[model samples]
Target: MPLLDATATHPITLPDGTLYRDTVYLKNVISHPRMEIGEYSYFTHCGKPEDTAEILAPYLGHSVRERLVIGKFVQIARGSYFITSSANHPMTGFTTYPFRIFKPETFGYKDLPVKDTVVGHDVWIGHDAAIMPGVQIGAGAIVAAASVVARDVPPYAVVGGNPATVIRMRYSPEIISALLDIAWWDWPVEKIETNLAFLETGDLAALKMA
Candidate 1:
């Protein structure tokens, strides 16, 4: 049987061949206009499949200017959520209270600068991780559980803690560059399957040859 099915909302089949309802392919479940999700990006949550976008990013409204862009093969564990630019209060003022929001016609704060949140391909976000707005997580990055990521993460970095800091780079600069160049995630599924051994084993030489 083929390993990946892009159309399957519940993609993970258990050992007993029963579908796991807690995980869903984000692309198949999410239909938000402000969000752009790549194929095979799965989000593990206990919420309804149709509410995946809302649960993942509660503050990203349909009318919001900023977008949530998630790339392919990303694995997001349960309890992880994104705090988009829209979630920000009027921090520039003396009082953080949003007085303008009380009136229907004067729902201000539209002028607040908003930036998109981007998650790169093959990233693994751990449980209860909180990604702040405008943060760009590079491909193959691993965000530790309960992390609060406020800054951009480099490719293949392992980050942890509040205001997440890079714990370490998964590979040396030379190897990281080569992997980025290889970009196996962009390859056809069949080709990827054929080279799965190299990917799983971290055989860079073999992958380069593939």
Candidate 2:
């Protein structure tokens, strides 16, 4: 019902720069400390979106929005850095000795032209990881801890590295083929609830397997 209880056991405050187009899309089933979070989402013990200690781990930036974009059912370990945007230096012909250095950011300093950090549903980011800007992490993907993601990840894929590389797909192309055909998650809630057991464990060899 209520997203948060003002009387939290510990300090909890609304986070800045975190926004959802629709509030109904945000859900908080558990509340203990003060943190800014999104819906159908739960932060891990150290998953506080801001402080990483009392609150969800925060980034180095002045605005939290430039750091992370989490999707439904994500589990991000502590000390993860999502650098969605930064002081991108003008490398071409500025000739200003150290152009990399930022200069009192102008009109475009606060927000990126395209807010492009994304995290898909049921994804898990391990401890001490970093996600870079303009990166789109696909649904049901797993990013191992201590990895660095630099490119786009495909759905249900697993990636890790200094510049994250696709180690492999979670499921064989065949298995995924059937699962896609069934598209069980799209089923009505009532239907899914009734068939949960089969969907969760049944090995789809195809046909009735689906």
Candidate 3:
């Protein structure tokens, strides 16, 4: 049996002529409408990616609408799960029982203010990582495997561990600044191909000249 339906929708193609489906290591069970995944950004669900809208009142003091925005050229490894709004529950109640969720007529849904989880361009997320909601991962950040990201990650920083602390920066401060200014991820396909050598060689002079 196929992992995804034959008629399932796919919108992006990678540099090596592979569809996003080919790179996705897990099952594509749901179509995410609340997610705005940009060019070349992909995820592996481990066959259990979260895409639910129902937020239990116990988990959340109120109901919340989840949104995920991923930017271009992002690399996501297998077994990575994004925590959706459904998983973010209230933390401060005498009893965590979400009676309001069961009895909507008796208690109307309360709205919880949850911001979108934003992943910036050229970021790399390693295997089995769990990214929490409302976290903003900056451009060119590297998330180590098995990490649980709960906060904002700075641009070009490498982070790891349960709470995802910064391990190091990918490059020197000057280099990071230069790379961010270059914004190669935003370059056109033809330009990227043309300057691929400079990118591959770390030849800043060549890139600048081009």
The most accurate candidate by TM-score is: 1
Task: Report the number of the highest-lDDT candidate.
Answer: 1
- Candidate 2 local lDDT, 137-195, one digit each (tens): 87778898899998898877899988889989989777666665666544554555566
- Cα lDDT of all candidates, in order? 0.96, 0.57, 0.68
Residue 184 CA error for candidate 2 (Å)? Answer: 5.2
Those runs of model 3 whose alpha carbons end farther than 4 Å from true positions after fitting are 1-22, 25-31, 45-64, 104-109
- Candidate 3 accuracy as lDDT: 0.68
Worst 10 residues of 3 by lDDT: 52-61
Model 3 clash number? 4
Winner on lDDT between 2 and 3 is: 3
- What is candidate 1's local distance difference test score? 0.96
Superposition error at 73 for model 2 (Å):
1.5
TM for candidate 2 is 0.59
lDDT of 3 by residue, 29-91 (tens): 334456566665555432322332111011222234657777876777766767755555555
Q: What is candidate 3's TM-score against the reference?
A: 0.74
Residue pairs with backbone overlap in model 1: none
Q: Which ten residues in a row have the lowest lDDT in candidate 1?
A: 100-109
TM-scores, each model vs. reference: 0.98, 0.59, 0.74
